[model samples]
Target: MNIKTQLKNFYLLQCGQFVSQLGSKITSYGLILWTYDNSGSVLSIALLTICTLIPSILLSFLAGSISDKWDKKNIMIISDSIAAFFSLIVLILLITNSLKIEYIYIINFILGVVDAFQNPASEVAISLIISKENYIRVSGIRSLSNSCITIFYPILSTTIYAFAGLKLIIFIDLATFIFAVLTLIFLVKIPKRIYNTGDNTNILHQCKIGIKYIVNDKGILSLILFMAFVNLIASIYNCNLQPMILSRNGNNKFQLGIVTATIGIAGVIGSILVTIKKESKKKIPVILNIMMFSFSICNTLLGIGRNYYIWTIAVFLGNVLVPFLTANVEFIMRNKVPLEMQGVVFSARNTLQYISIPIGYLLGGVLADKVFEPNVYKISFLTNIVGSGKGAGIALIYIVIGIIGFLGCCIFKLNNDMRNLDN
Candidate 1:
């Protein structure tokens, strides 16, 4: 099929996925609120993130190979179905008032496993359906959708939770999942799957193919390593962001909603810019530069700011640059990775790039609760710098993470291998 016709189908698929994504985000935000309200621990929230990441990291090798061998559409449909089933379980637990922190962790881990298979299939499906020239544009649209979700979910969830509670959010999530699955089955059309006869049947060998592909390419390997390091720093910042806002804001959901909305608005603006601009030649450098500025500016403000106003500005500016960074990265991946190997390679990419995230989540929580928060007052000078408050330790952490992230980007920019990815 022609690119235009394929794009029409892609848009229909996106619309379905968009609804699903929004519902998922709403559920996520509601859970965060529920978790924090009940536990009042940063560690609790960080553990939630770790639960999701660890399963994906552990199952990534197998998931990628399976995705490559299986039908992408079926994989997606099955994955979504499994996820919906788990959401139902969560709803049942909540209704029974039996949902506990441990249960949440288990549910999240299962969802992560589902995502491990689903994400690579979804990525491969997009690559198959969309032409190469439109990679960046499509990435922008994806980013735009995610940003829109980010902008609204906090507000929606907060309002919904206040009025109706978490049960209603889960209902919306289930409804969206149904819509997405139906759209995939009925409305969307993916190109026929083309199997590579040369592909080995051994699952182990198939999994190794992706690893070997990256390892053999020093430039791509270095790029992935750089991202891994960046994720480490980002994970810390992310794990703490909600806790910091809530702790410092007296657990005001509206403040959190407003700040989160600003981030989405910034992302929308950034996505628009990426969609309209011509692709750049120096993608690696662009990625590194954007990361450096984003971490430096956003983290700094977040650390220093005591109010939602500053938080809004910090996130807005930081997120505005994210779409450009992601667009360039996706553009490079599409140009460099062969379509037949994309599923595995992309999975390998995820495993390597996100491996540090679990560690970051764990460390961020420990440091916030055990180390920083406890010692914030003892270290009078440090407390003076960041100011004494409920989230003082987390504030210090943001500053440190931002600096490390900035320096890490700078160091990676000096790597010749990363620069050569453009060639």
Candidate 2:
């Protein structure tokens, strides 16, 4: 296919995927609010997150291997269909007044398993369809879509939850799933990878080959490790943000939604900026480190700021730096990794990066509830620094994690292998 035709087809696929994601995010946000309201425990939230992460992490390698063996479009369609079916089941349970916390955990676990296959398939599919020159720009565009989803989803979901509750929200998700499936089946045609007839490698051997490829490349391996550390620190903020904001704001759903919307707007602005700028061929690591530093500073500000307005600005500023960092990292991987091996390699990379996330989530919750929240009131020294309040302990944790993130960046800067990955 010509470049023009290829770009057209690629974007058509993205449009369908984006619509499905929009619906999914709305339902996700609504469920989060419902879970938090009913449980009122940070640990409960942590458990939900753990259930999601563990399945994906465990299945990532297998999923990646499967993606390489199958048609990417078919894998995605199957994954989305399974997820939608489960969502419908949840909706039925809700309508019957039998929806429980256990059900959400079980459903999230299943979705995570399906996503393990879907994510790598989708990533590899993009590499198949788009030209190398467009990787960075396309990454930015994808980020922009995510930003738009974040921007609108919170506002819409909160409003819906207030009036109609989860039933209507879930129905919307089911419809979007069908739309996405139909689009893939009819509108988008994904090119398949051709394997060598003489090669006949088993899945386990292919998995090892993918691992060896990364291990032999010190630069890429170091970069992945650095990112794993960064993700570990960031996960704490992710798990706790809602609880902190809700605790400080009297558990007001509307206020939490506003903060989320503001952050999403910042993300949209960042994604737009990245899309507009000409792509740089060098100094990617330097630019990524700079963005990470800026992000760290924003997190620090969020921790120290007492006013809601200040918190909003901090959230906005922090999210604004995300797209640039994410796009550059994606560009590196897409450029460095071969198309055929991307499914396994990307899965391996994700497994390494994501392993720490659940650890961070579980620890963040435990530290906040068991250690920090109760003791912050008792510790005179901490109280004097972060100030005394309900959410003060969580705020302090954010500051510590932010500082740790900056330190991780500094370490990355000092690592010659990671810094020279693009070169």
The per-model lDDT (C-alpha) reads 0.89, 0.85
Per residue, candidate 2 scores C-alpha lDDT tens digits across 1-423 of: 788888888888999999999999898888888898899888888888888888998899888888888889999999999999999998999989999999999999999998899998898888889999888788888999899989899989999999999899999999999899999999998886643112577778777777888999888898788778877877788888889988887878888788889878988998998899876666556455655766587778778877678788888888887888888888888889887788888888989889999999999999899888888888788776677789889988988888778876776778788777767
Give TM-scores for every candidate, taking all chains together and pairing residue i with residue i. 0.98, 0.96
Which candidate number would show the highest lDDT if scored against the true structure?
A: 1
RMSD to native for every prediction? 1.1, 1.6
| lDDT (tens digit, per residue) of candidate 1 on 1-423 | 787897898899899889988988899888888999899999999988899999999899898888888888899899999989999999999999999989999999999999899888888888888988788889999999989998999899999998999999999999999999999999988877754314557777877888999999998899889889988998898889999998899988889899989989999999999988877877887899899999999999999998999999999888898999888888888889888888778888999999999999999999999998888888879876788988988999989989999988888988998898887
Each model's backbone clash number: 0, 0
Model 2's alpha-carbon lDDT is: 0.85
**TM-score result, candidate 2:** 0.96
Candidate 2: where is the Cα deviation over 4 Å? Answer: 194-199
Error of 2 at 231 (Å): 1.2
